[model samples]
Target: MFRGNKDEVFVRQALEQADYACGRWIASQRHFDVDPTSLLEPLAKAAVVTAVAIYVETARLSQLEVQRALAIETVAQARALIDRLHPLAFGGGWYGGRALR
Candidate 1:
C-alpha cells in the first residue's frame, strides 16, 4: 500500500476538486437555464488540471498524461481550472495512481 504525505497533498486535492467539478457539472445539467456545451472547456480543463495535480503529487505518470495536464500556456486559466476542480483532490489518499492492491 502507498501512503501519501503532505508533499502529495496537492495531487489529492486536485483529484478531489476534479470530482467536485464533475458533481457541479452534473447539477448544472439538471437545469434548463444553462447549456452543457458552455461548460465544455471548464469541465475538461478541471479534469486535465486535476490530473496534472495528481502527476505533481506522485511525480509519476505517462508523458502524454503530463503533456495533457501540466503543459499549460497560461497561469490564469490554470488557476481558474484548478478552482473548478473537486475538493476531494485534497482529501482521500488518491495518488493519481491506482489503488494499491
Candidate 2:
C-alpha cells in the first residue's frame, strides 16, 4: 500500500513537471521561432494521458496491479516528454543528442 501510494505520488509529480515544461515550451516558442502547431499535438496528448492516469490512480487505488502498471507507464511517458522538451523549453544544454539550446 505504501509503495503504491509512493508510486502514485511520483507519477503525479512527474505529470505536473511535464505540464510545466509544456507551458514553458509554448511560451518560449515565439522566442525560439518554433511553430506551435508542430509541437501542440504531442503536448496536448501528453496532457490528456496524464490526466487519465491521474484519474485512474486516484479512482482505483485499491487495484494495485492496474494502478502500478499505469503509474509506471505514465511516468515513463511523462519522463520521455520532459526529456524531449527540457532543452527546448529551458534552453540549458543538449538533450537526447538534439541541440535545443
Candidate 3:
C-alpha cells in the first residue's frame, strides 16, 4: 500500500514521467477533475509487473529468481486492471493513435 504523502507525491511524479514518455497530456489536463486514483489504477498494475520483472532480471545476475507469489500477484493484478480499462482507453485518437472508429 502507498505509505501516504511522500509516496503519493512520488506516485504523481511517476505518472507525470510516464505521461511525458508516452507523449500524453498531463493527467490534470487530460483527466481534468477526475480523481487521481482512477488514473493510477492502471499504472499501479503496470508498475507491479515492471518492478517484479526488474527484480527477476537483476536476480538472474546473481543466479537467483523470483518467487511464484510475485508471478501470481502480477497475473491477478493484470486481469483486474484489464477488466477495469475502458475500450476508449485503448482506442481512438486520444492517445496519439488513430481512432478505432
TM-scores of the candidates are: 0.27, 0.26, 0.26
Error of 1 at 65 (Å): 3.0
Which ranges of candidate 3 are over 4 A from the true structure?
1-4, 20-84, 88-101
TM-score of model 1 relative to the true fold? 0.27
Off by over 4 Å in 2: 1-40, 61-101
Q: lDDT per residue, candidate 2, 41-73, as tens digits? A: 444444434543443454432244333334333
For residue 46, model 3's alpha carbon misses the true position, in angstroms, by 2.4
Of the pair 1 and 2, which is ahead by TM-score? Answer: 1
Across residues 26-93, which tens digit of lDDT does each residue of candidate 1 receive? 43433323353343445545555555656445544445555545554444444444443323234333
Best by lDDT: 1
Clashing residue pairs for model 3: none
Error of 2 at 88 (Å): 36
Using lDDT as the yardstick, the better of models 1 and 2 is 1
Candidate 3: C-alpha lDDT: 0.40
Cα lDDT, all candidates: 0.47, 0.45, 0.40
Error (Å) of candidate 1 at residue 54 is 0.8
The alpha-carbon deviation from the true structure for residue 89 of candidate 2, after best TM-score superposition, in angstroms, is 31
